[model samples]
Target: MQRNAFMLLMDEPRSTLDPIATAQVDELIDELRQNYLVAVVTHAMHQAARVSQKTAFLHLGNLVEYGETGTVFANPTDPRTESYITGRIG
Candidate 1:
Protein backbone atom coordinates (compact mmCIF):
# COMPACT_ATOMS: atom_id res chain seq x y z
CA MET A 1 0.00 0.00 0.00
CA GLN A 2 1.15 3.60 -0.59
CA ARG A 3 0.77 4.21 3.12
CA ASN A 4 3.50 1.74 3.99
CA ALA A 5 6.01 3.01 1.44
CA PHE A 6 8.85 5.26 2.59
CA MET A 7 10.49 6.29 -0.65
CA LEU A 8 9.67 6.40 -4.34
CA LEU A 9 12.29 5.99 -7.06
CA MET A 10 11.21 6.83 -10.57
CA ASP A 11 13.37 6.40 -13.63
CA GLU A 12 12.40 8.77 -16.42
CA PRO A 13 8.78 8.43 -15.28
CA ARG A 14 7.77 11.36 -17.44
CA SER A 15 9.46 10.35 -20.67
CA THR A 16 6.30 8.93 -22.23
CA LEU A 17 3.93 11.43 -20.67
CA ASP A 18 2.48 14.43 -22.43
CA PRO A 19 3.34 17.89 -21.12
CA ILE A 20 0.11 18.23 -19.13
CA ALA A 21 0.45 14.81 -17.58
CA THR A 22 4.10 15.42 -16.81
CA ALA A 23 3.17 18.50 -14.77
CA GLN A 24 0.55 16.53 -12.89
CA VAL A 25 3.11 13.87 -12.07
CA ASP A 26 5.52 16.55 -10.86
CA GLU A 27 2.84 17.88 -8.56
CA LEU A 28 2.16 14.41 -7.25
CA ILE A 29 5.84 13.89 -6.61
CA ASP A 30 5.99 17.10 -4.62
CA GLU A 31 3.09 15.91 -2.50
CA LEU A 32 4.72 12.55 -1.98
CA ARG A 33 7.95 14.26 -0.89
CA GLN A 34 6.11 15.59 2.11
CA ASN A 35 6.37 12.05 3.50
CA TYR A 36 9.32 10.38 1.80
CA LEU A 37 12.73 10.70 0.25
CA VAL A 38 11.96 10.71 -3.47
CA ALA A 39 14.82 9.66 -5.72
CA VAL A 40 14.15 10.41 -9.36
CA VAL A 41 16.71 9.41 -11.94
CA THR A 42 16.05 11.37 -15.08
CA HIS A 43 17.94 12.56 -18.11
CA ALA A 44 15.73 15.62 -18.24
CA MET A 45 17.37 18.57 -16.55
CA HIS A 46 14.11 20.42 -16.17
CA GLN A 47 12.39 17.43 -14.62
CA ALA A 48 15.16 17.09 -12.04
CA ALA A 49 14.90 20.80 -11.34
CA ARG A 50 11.20 20.47 -10.73
CA VAL A 51 11.10 17.58 -8.25
CA SER A 52 14.38 17.38 -6.39
CA GLN A 53 16.34 19.47 -3.94
CA LYS A 54 19.54 17.51 -4.47
CA THR A 55 20.81 15.95 -7.67
CA ALA A 56 23.55 13.45 -8.42
CA PHE A 57 24.94 13.66 -11.93
CA LEU A 58 26.39 10.36 -13.00
CA HIS A 59 28.55 9.97 -16.10
CA LEU A 60 29.98 6.75 -17.43
CA GLY A 61 29.88 4.91 -14.11
CA ASN A 62 31.31 7.89 -12.28
CA LEU A 63 29.67 10.11 -9.67
CA VAL A 64 30.36 13.57 -10.98
CA GLU A 65 28.74 15.89 -8.52
CA TYR A 66 26.63 15.64 -5.35
CA GLY A 67 25.18 18.75 -3.78
CA GLU A 68 22.25 21.12 -3.59
CA THR A 69 20.35 21.46 -6.83
CA GLY A 70 20.94 25.18 -7.10
CA THR A 71 24.63 24.87 -6.41
CA VAL A 72 25.04 22.08 -8.89
CA PHE A 73 23.08 23.82 -11.56
CA ALA A 74 24.38 27.33 -11.07
CA ASN A 75 28.00 26.53 -10.49
CA PRO A 76 29.03 22.96 -11.20
CA THR A 77 32.65 22.27 -10.26
CA ASP A 78 33.21 19.43 -12.69
CA PRO A 79 34.05 20.27 -16.30
CA ARG A 80 31.76 17.43 -17.31
CA THR A 81 28.94 19.02 -15.40
CA GLU A 82 29.58 22.34 -17.08
CA SER A 83 29.59 20.83 -20.53
CA TYR A 84 26.44 18.85 -19.87
CA ILE A 85 24.52 21.74 -18.39
CA THR A 86 25.54 24.38 -20.86
CA GLY A 87 25.41 22.16 -23.93
CA ARG A 88 28.45 23.86 -25.33
CA ILE A 89 30.89 20.98 -25.66
CA GLY A 90 28.92 17.91 -24.65
Candidate 2:
Protein backbone atom coordinates (compact mmCIF):
# COMPACT_ATOMS: atom_id res chain seq x y z
CA MET A 1 0.00 0.00 0.00
CA GLN A 2 1.00 3.63 -0.56
CA ARG A 3 0.62 6.49 1.84
CA ASN A 4 1.28 10.19 2.01
CA ALA A 5 3.36 11.56 4.84
CA PHE A 6 4.08 15.17 5.69
CA MET A 7 6.58 14.59 8.43
CA LEU A 8 8.59 11.69 9.79
CA LEU A 9 9.62 11.47 13.42
CA MET A 10 12.42 9.01 14.07
CA ASP A 11 13.94 8.42 17.50
CA GLU A 12 17.31 6.79 17.09
CA PRO A 13 16.27 4.80 14.05
CA ARG A 14 19.81 3.46 13.74
CA SER A 15 20.34 2.70 17.44
CA THR A 16 20.93 -1.07 17.30
CA LEU A 17 22.53 -1.20 13.86
CA ASP A 18 26.18 -1.72 13.09
CA PRO A 19 28.22 0.86 11.18
CA ILE A 20 27.21 -0.52 7.79
CA ALA A 21 23.53 -0.54 8.67
CA THR A 22 23.71 2.92 10.22
CA ALA A 23 25.23 4.28 7.05
CA GLN A 24 22.46 2.67 5.01
CA VAL A 25 19.79 4.17 7.22
CA ASP A 26 21.45 7.58 7.09
CA GLU A 27 21.48 7.42 3.32
CA LEU A 28 17.81 6.53 3.23
CA ILE A 29 16.96 9.36 5.65
CA ASP A 30 18.88 11.80 3.48
CA GLU A 31 16.97 10.63 0.42
CA LEU A 32 13.66 10.78 2.22
CA ARG A 33 14.39 14.37 3.28
CA GLN A 34 13.86 15.34 -0.35
CA ASN A 35 10.14 14.59 0.03
CA TYR A 36 9.42 14.67 3.73
CA LEU A 37 10.36 16.71 6.76
CA VAL A 38 12.47 14.28 8.75
CA ALA A 39 12.96 14.97 12.45
CA VAL A 40 15.54 12.75 14.06
CA VAL A 41 16.31 12.52 17.76
CA THR A 42 19.78 11.09 18.12
CA HIS A 43 22.62 11.20 20.62
CA ALA A 44 25.17 10.62 17.88
CA MET A 45 26.31 14.14 17.06
CA HIS A 46 28.10 13.01 13.92
CA GLN A 47 24.98 11.37 12.61
CA ALA A 48 22.95 14.51 13.35
CA ALA A 49 25.54 16.59 11.52
CA ARG A 50 25.27 14.30 8.53
CA VAL A 51 21.53 13.94 7.98
CA SER A 52 19.93 17.07 9.36
CA GLN A 53 19.40 20.37 7.61
CA LYS A 54 18.11 21.93 10.84
CA THR A 55 18.90 20.92 14.40
CA ALA A 56 17.53 21.45 17.84
CA PHE A 57 19.85 20.95 20.78
CA LEU A 58 18.28 20.24 24.10
CA HIS A 59 19.59 19.91 27.64
CA LEU A 60 17.86 18.67 30.74
CA GLY A 61 14.48 18.96 29.04
CA ASN A 62 15.19 22.50 27.95
CA LEU A 63 15.87 23.68 24.41
CA VAL A 64 19.28 25.25 24.30
CA GLU A 65 19.38 26.14 20.63
CA TYR A 66 17.67 25.61 17.32
CA GLY A 67 18.92 26.64 13.93
CA GLU A 68 20.59 25.42 10.78
CA THR A 69 22.47 22.24 11.61
CA GLY A 70 25.83 23.55 10.48
CA THR A 71 25.57 26.72 12.47
CA VAL A 72 24.39 25.02 15.62
CA PHE A 73 27.10 22.41 15.48
CA ALA A 74 29.88 24.67 14.23
CA ASN A 75 29.04 27.92 15.99
CA PRO A 76 26.44 27.54 18.65
CA THR A 77 25.13 30.71 20.29
CA ASP A 78 24.61 29.08 23.67
CA PRO A 79 27.32 27.75 25.95
CA ARG A 80 25.18 24.77 26.90
CA THR A 81 24.82 23.87 23.27
CA GLU A 82 28.53 24.23 22.74
CA SER A 83 29.37 22.12 25.76
CA TYR A 84 27.12 19.27 24.77
CA ILE A 85 28.33 19.25 21.18
CA THR A 86 31.95 19.35 22.25
CA GLY A 87 31.68 16.31 24.57
CA ARG A 88 31.90 18.35 27.74
CA ILE A 89 28.63 16.74 28.70
CA GLY A 90 26.82 13.59 27.71
Candidate 3:
Protein backbone atom coordinates (compact mmCIF):
# COMPACT_ATOMS: atom_id res chain seq x y z
CA MET A 1 0.00 0.00 0.00
CA GLN A 2 1.07 3.57 -0.62
CA ARG A 3 -0.08 6.88 0.75
CA ASN A 4 0.41 10.48 -0.16
CA ALA A 5 -0.07 13.78 1.60
CA PHE A 6 -2.05 16.57 -0.03
CA MET A 7 -1.32 19.15 2.60
CA LEU A 8 1.63 20.28 4.67
CA LEU A 9 1.30 22.17 7.93
CA MET A 10 4.35 23.82 9.41
CA ASP A 11 4.63 25.66 12.67
CA GLU A 12 7.55 28.03 12.77
CA PRO A 13 9.36 25.79 10.30
CA ARG A 14 12.38 28.06 10.24
CA SER A 15 12.35 29.20 13.83
CA THR A 16 15.36 27.15 14.93
CA LEU A 17 17.18 26.99 11.60
CA ASP A 18 20.19 29.13 10.88
CA PRO A 19 20.01 31.68 8.02
CA ILE A 20 21.33 29.33 5.32
CA ALA A 21 19.18 26.44 6.46
CA THR A 22 16.15 28.69 6.69
CA ALA A 23 16.62 29.76 3.08
CA GLN A 24 16.90 26.17 2.02
CA VAL A 25 13.71 25.26 3.88
CA ASP A 26 11.89 28.18 2.33
CA GLU A 27 12.97 27.00 -1.10
CA LEU A 28 11.72 23.51 -0.34
CA ILE A 29 8.38 24.97 0.73
CA ASP A 30 8.09 26.77 -2.61
CA GLU A 31 8.57 23.48 -4.41
CA LEU A 32 6.12 21.67 -2.14
CA ARG A 33 3.36 24.13 -2.96
CA GLN A 34 3.19 22.73 -6.47
CA ASN A 35 1.82 19.46 -5.09
CA TYR A 36 0.45 20.27 -1.62
CA LEU A 37 -1.63 22.74 0.28
CA VAL A 38 1.04 24.39 2.39
CA ALA A 39 -0.12 26.02 5.59
CA VAL A 40 2.55 27.82 7.52
CA VAL A 41 2.12 29.22 10.98
CA THR A 42 4.71 31.75 11.91
CA HIS A 43 5.20 34.93 13.91
CA ALA A 44 7.70 36.11 11.33
CA MET A 45 5.78 38.56 9.14
CA HIS A 46 8.43 38.72 6.47
CA GLN A 47 8.41 34.96 6.01
CA ALA A 48 4.63 34.94 5.66
CA ALA A 49 4.84 37.60 2.98
CA ARG A 50 7.49 35.68 1.15
CA VAL A 51 5.88 32.24 1.21
CA SER A 52 2.10 32.60 1.21
CA GLN A 53 -0.26 33.69 -1.52
CA LYS A 54 -3.09 34.32 0.92
CA THR A 55 -2.86 35.66 4.44
CA ALA A 56 -5.09 35.03 7.43
CA PHE A 57 -4.71 37.20 10.47
CA LEU A 58 -5.86 35.61 13.69
CA HIS A 59 -5.87 37.22 17.10
CA LEU A 60 -6.91 35.65 20.38
CA GLY A 61 -8.20 32.62 18.49
CA ASN A 62 -10.47 34.80 16.40
CA LEU A 63 -9.96 35.27 12.70
CA VAL A 64 -9.67 38.98 12.00
CA GLU A 65 -8.86 39.28 8.32
CA TYR A 66 -8.10 37.12 5.29
CA GLY A 67 -7.13 38.12 1.80
CA GLU A 68 -4.34 38.15 -0.72
CA THR A 69 -1.01 38.38 1.09
CA GLY A 70 -0.13 41.66 -0.58
CA THR A 71 -3.44 43.23 0.38
CA VAL A 72 -3.35 41.97 3.93
CA PHE A 73 0.13 43.34 4.35
CA ALA A 74 -0.41 46.54 2.41
CA ASN A 75 -4.01 47.42 3.29
CA PRO A 76 -5.60 45.35 5.98
CA THR A 77 -9.32 46.01 6.49
CA ASP A 78 -9.27 45.34 10.23
CA PRO A 79 -7.63 47.63 12.73
CA ARG A 80 -6.27 44.67 14.66
CA THR A 81 -4.66 43.34 11.52
CA GLU A 82 -3.19 46.74 10.80
CA SER A 83 -1.85 47.07 14.32
CA TYR A 84 -0.24 43.67 14.36
CA ILE A 85 1.31 43.94 10.91
CA THR A 86 2.65 47.39 11.57
CA GLY A 87 4.45 46.35 14.79
CA ARG A 88 2.02 48.38 16.87
CA ILE A 89 0.79 45.24 18.60
CA GLY A 90 1.67 41.58 18.79
| Candidate that would win on TM-score | 3
Candidate 1 accuracy as lDDT: 0.87
Residue 35 error, candidate 2, Å: 1.2
- In model 1, the Cα lDDT at residue 19 comes to 95
The better-scoring model by TM-score among 1 and 2 is 2
lDDT of 1 at 46: 84
The regions of model 3 sitting more than 4 angstroms off are none
Per-residue lDDT tens digits for candidate 2, residues 13-90, read 889899999999999998988988889999999999999989999888888899999999999999989989999988
Q: Could you tell me which 10 consecutive residues in candidate 1 have the lowest summed lDDT?
A: 81-90
lDDT of 2 at 64: 80
Question: In model 2, how many backbone clashes occur?
Answer: 0
lDDT (Cα, tens digit) per residue for candidate 1, span 46-90: 888778899898989999898999988889889898788777664
Q: For residues 1-90, what per-residue lDDT tens digits would candidate 3 score against the true structure?
A: 126978889999989788898888889989989988999999989889998999999999999999999999999999999999899997
Residue 7's lDDT within candidate 3 is 83
TM accuracy, model 1: 0.88
